[model samples]
Target: MTESGTLYVVATPIGNLGDITQRAISTLQLVDAIAAEDTRHTVGLLRHLGISKPLLAVHEHNEQQSAQGLIKRLQAGESIALVTDAGTPAVSDPGALVVQGVRQAGLAVVPIPGVSAVITALSAAGIVQPGFYFEGFLPASGSQRRKRLEILKTLPTTLVFYEAPHRIVECVTDLAAVLGGHRQLTLARELTKTFETIHTCGLAEAVAWLQADPNQQRGEFVLLVHADVQEKAEGLDDETLRILQRLLQELPLKQAVALATDITGQKKNELYEAALAFKAANTHE
Candidate 1:
């Protein structure tokens, strides 16, 4: 009777091939078969590392069927390694179903952790705290994206998201609209690759900076928006107070306060009282 084999979930480098761990290399070399999101892409990496093994396609379209086959191979004492094009397998990628299926079949599933774009971005974000909520890849549509942003806006911990090149501009625009220009964000572009840029700036500045350079939108993006802040009574800066005052001119008091709250990420009651006070003081003047 053949002893059942282990299922190894390996992490590959996101960009620089050198980022791959030695254990990952050994696992790939020693495994009976390799299940990959894209066999062609993984082949290039294996060749670069001078390691060759059987490659199986297990992408989004056929992950379920592929997982079943991989499980059978495991049961038959063939050790398997699951890998994505980059980063950890099954992380905003594929392999979750396979991992679950393997464990359910009483097979061992081991992790080989390495570079993650989300963590890579957050580490340099200067976010002070260790807490974060990773919301990988926002919805494609404008309306759906905005709806998702609104729900995430009030979270107290830092928020992270992955975005593609084409949608980055609109994603940043929607972020500014829903979460306000006052909030700070860290934009990490083309991480670990040449021309990589990681910039921390206010939302408004980040938008303007990207708009100023077409090249800035060309690569992968990981956006890290700072957490919601609870400010003191007089925390509204002169610029914010000015915007609130301007909004009051064309909007109803309630509407103006709500807009101010969205724009500043400040408490609604605090903004309302301030708006009322500003209005009353102006009336006297």
Candidate 2:
């Protein structure tokens, strides 16, 4: 029987092929096989590096089943490398299951870290960085997304999120509306690659900036929103304000304020006044 081999969780460059670490390259070359989120993408990277090896498709959809097979290979002394199309694996990507399986099977799992969008954007964002929160990608649905943002609104740490091109504008719009227009934010698009753009501005101006240039809407994105600096209006967050405004559309002003107070724990009178302003401004819009 063959002895078990180590499973290496390798990090690839998010962009700029030259950014790939020497250790990652050497590990990939030495491994028996690579379990990739996308086999075709990994194939291209391997071709560029002039290193050919077996590729296994281990993406989100088939991860659980694929991990079992990968575990078997590892147990048979076939050292395997885990890679995603970009950046690190098992981080808003595939490979965690396989790593866990390998460990559970009494095989070693080693991390070969390099570039990550969360750290890449944070290093350049210029925001006060005692600490930060990585929320990854928010939920696609508006209400669900807002709820998640609500939970994040009160955190004192900077918030980081990964978003795709198609939904970026909408995501920024929701961020501006739910997080307060004046809150600071940084948008890092296509990091470490050609045409890379990183800009920090107020949430209010973010929508216009994104819309001003059509090209801004293209490519992968990492968004960093600054932490809440001070308590907002009537001690109510932008999320509670949003809910109060929505409630006003169907309920009486008093009733809306009551519900908002109950849901958000703000003073009812303050909520009533805020709800009135929200209704009047939205009406003008």
Candidate 3:
């Protein structure tokens, strides 16, 4: 019986061809064939590297079906390299199903990691928060996106999101509305490309900044929302605290805070802080 071949999950440059890693190039050259998110896009990268291999179209539309075929190839002792149009595969991108399927079949799946848009943006963001929540792309629906943001609003860690150029203006508007205009936001646009721009400002100012220059709204964006630090809850009276805690038991933290604000006429930020404290106290017990 022939030994099963390895499946390499390689990360390519997000932009700037020079960013491609030596190991990634070597793996691509060595693989029997490559499974690409977009064959037309991957062909350019492969051509640039002077590597030739059979290209298979394994995209979101046919990932599950493609996975089975890939497994059969690996079983036939044909090594394969999986790559997305840019950055790593299976991360806010296709190839996840293929990787999962290959693994379940007991085939070896190796990672040749390199450039990632998320890590690249966060590296230069200058955010002091110790950790981050990578929310990736939010729902395209405005109402659904806002609902998700509401739940994430009070998080004490940095929030990382990916946004498309066309929806950037509207996305920023919703962000300011739900996450608060006062919070700091870092916009990393067209990363690693010729027109790359990284700017930081308050959420309220993000929309204006993007609109003032049309070019600014023309590329992929990585938005970094600064962490929310809970303020002192000393101003809350016993009645308000009681009300907030009671609401917390039956509602999400953001909802609890909002209802408490209406009931006690306390500031929303203050009520949010109190709600976090109450939840933390309960968690430790």
| Candidate 1 residue pairs in clash (backbone atoms < 3 Å) | none
lDDT of each: 0.83, 0.83, 0.85
Residues 1-285 of candidate 3: C-alpha lDDT, one tens digit per residue: 112388999999999999999999888888899999999999999999999999999999999999999999999999999999989999999988999999999999999999999999988877655788999999999999999999999787789999999899999999989987645688999999999999876677789999999999998999998774333477776567667766776788988888888888999988887776655433210
Worst 10 residues of 3 by lDDT: 276-285
- Taking all chains together, each candidate's TM-score versus the true structure is 0.81, 0.80, 0.81
TM-score, predicted candidate 2 vs. hidden true structure: 0.80
Candidate 1, residues 1-285: lDDT per residue as tens digits? 112389999999999999999888888888888999999999999999999899999999999998899988998889988999989988899999999999998999999899999989877766765588999999999999999999998887788999999999899999988987756678999999998998876676677899899999888899998764423236777577656766876788899998988998888887887776645433210
Candidate 2 total steric clashes: 0
- True-vs-predicted CA distance for residue 82, candidate 2, Å: 0.2
Q: lDDT value for candidate 1? A: 0.83
Q: Candidate 3: misplaced stretches above 4 Å?
A: 1-4, 230-285
Evaluated against the true structure, the overall lDDT of model 2 is 0.83
Cα error of candidate 1 at position 214, Å: 1.3
For TM-score, the strongest prediction is 1
> Tens digits of per-residue lDDT for model 2 on 1-285?
112388889999999999899999999888988899999999989999999999999999999999999888887889888999999999988888888888888888889999998998888876644788899999998889989998898786778999999999889999988888746678999999998999876677798999999999999999998765434345777667657656776788888888788888988777776765544333211
Tell me which of candidates 1 and 2 scores higher on TM-score: 1
Candidate 1 or 3, higher lDDT? 3
